[model samples]
Target: MKEKQIKQFEEALAQKLYKLDTEKHARAIGEAAYIDEETFISPDFFLYARCLVVVQGKEFYEYVV
Candidate 1:
């Protein structure tokens, strides 16, 4: 794909990923991972958690995130 097309696709995919995220889903994984409340509050941790969710693939993401 062209660079512009790739950017558009990435933006769309990011939207889908964000739409899949919910407070309940975030809290569930944080609890499961034993992540401290303080650390969980960090924006970086949230982004990392989201990446982890997507990397697990569609079925797992649907099941957990």
Candidate 2:
């Protein structure tokens, strides 16, 4: 796919997911930034965790922003 086409697709998808409150949706068990106990996961893993970080970018975009 071309760059512009990819950008368009991303914009469209981002809007559909924009309404979600990721923090509330995600399960939080440990303090972010620094932790010793429990394993920390990407916020995108709230519902489905992907083995690859790139595939999980949607969650990262939704939460980290």
Q: Which candidate gets the maximum lDDT versus the true structure?
A: 1
The C-alpha RMSD in Å for every predicted model, in order, reads: 3.6, 8.5
Q: Per-residue CA lDDT of candidate 1, range 23-64, in tens?
A: 655566544443446653555666678778777888977776
Tens digits of lDDT, candidate 2, 19-64: 4434543333234422323756555543332223224676775454
Please list the C-alpha lDDT of all candidates, in the order they appear: 0.68, 0.48
Best by TM-score: 1
Candidate 1 collision pairs: none
Candidate 2, pairs of clashing residues:
none
Local lDDT at 15 for model 2: 60
User: After aligning candidate 2 to the native by TM-score, how far in Å is the CA of 46 from where it should be?
Assistant: 2.9
Q: In candidate 1, what residue range of length 10 has the lowest lDDT sum? A: 31-40
